[model samples]
Target: EINEIIRHLNNSAPGSDNLSSFFFKDTIDYVASIITHLTNESSRTGQFPDILKEGKIIQLPEISNAINFSELRPITILTVLEKILEEFVYKQLIDYLDEKNSH
Candidate 1:
């Protein structure tokens, strides 16, 4: 899990939280345990923190190549913590699917 987070930190862009993966990656060793704890708490409670989900929507009309505002591509910049949660949830889903497939 830490490895996956680290991978994203190095390759992904900073989110609205203004916390870049590089920041966490460089300090992964120090924060990995804390993140793991938070991850577990979030799962056991079956609730994601409201703060983590607070992200900014970046609209890119030029990139979307559309004149209509609705046609613009919207990107979500999640907090670093939220990004980690997203990865953790993704892994859980993948594992569940793989387990079911093996049945």
Candidate 2:
């Protein structure tokens, strides 16, 4: 699951952990188990590590010359771990919905 999720991730900016998508894809063979464990633990415990919840919010201007607050979009950059965990839960939710709808 981790490998499948990581394969589709974009090379976006890193969060507070400073870990990028490339880092995960490159080191997946060596780190997949550790990440999987963390993600599973988080799911079992119903609580995520503080770092996983942390994100860096940056405001990007909609136009080259932005002057108003509405012109700026706030983007939150979360860690690769967070992204993986999210994908896991998302896939589960989608599967559950699919199964429910099938019956």
Candidate 3:
């Protein structure tokens, strides 16, 4: 699942860590076990590392000829690891909700 998620991630600019999604995709074979362990540990402990939560915010103009701050959009670039963690949490939440609804 982690590998699938990493495979689908866009090759966009990295966050505070400066490691892009492409990097993860390229190294998934070597890093899959470590990432899976990290994700599982985080889930079991119900705690996420502060380092993974860090993001880099950059403002880009909504229009080509933008003139003011209002015309700009803030894009928060997060690490691929953070995104993977989010996907795991999201799947768990959805599964919980589905189970609740089924009952």
Over 4 Å off, model 3:
none
Ten contiguous residues with the weakest lDDT in model 1:
2-11
Candidate 2: minimum summed lDDT over ten consecutive residues — where? 46-55
Q: Which of the numbered candidates is closest to the native, going by highest lDDT?
A: 2
Worst 10 residues of 3 by lDDT: 4-13
Q: What is the TM-score of each candidate against the true structure?
A: 0.80, 0.89, 0.86
Give the CA lDDT, 0 to 100, for residue 59 in model 3.
93
Model 2, 86: alpha-carbon shift in Å? 0.8
lDDT of each: 0.78, 0.86, 0.85
**For model 2, how does the per-residue alpha-carbon lDDT over 1-103 read when each residue is reduced to its tens digit?**
8888987888988888898999999988977888788778877898878767788899999998999999999999888778888998899889999999999
Considering TM-score, where higher is better, how would the candidates rank from best to worst? 2, 3, 1
Descending-lDDT candidate ranking:
2, 3, 1
Which digits, one per residue and each the tens of the lDDT, describe model 1 over residues 1-103?
A: 8556666764566776678777888888888888888888988998777777688888878554588887787888777777777778888989999999999
Better of 1 and 3 by TM-score: 3
| Clashing residue pairs found in predicted model 2 | none
Clash pairs of candidate 3? none
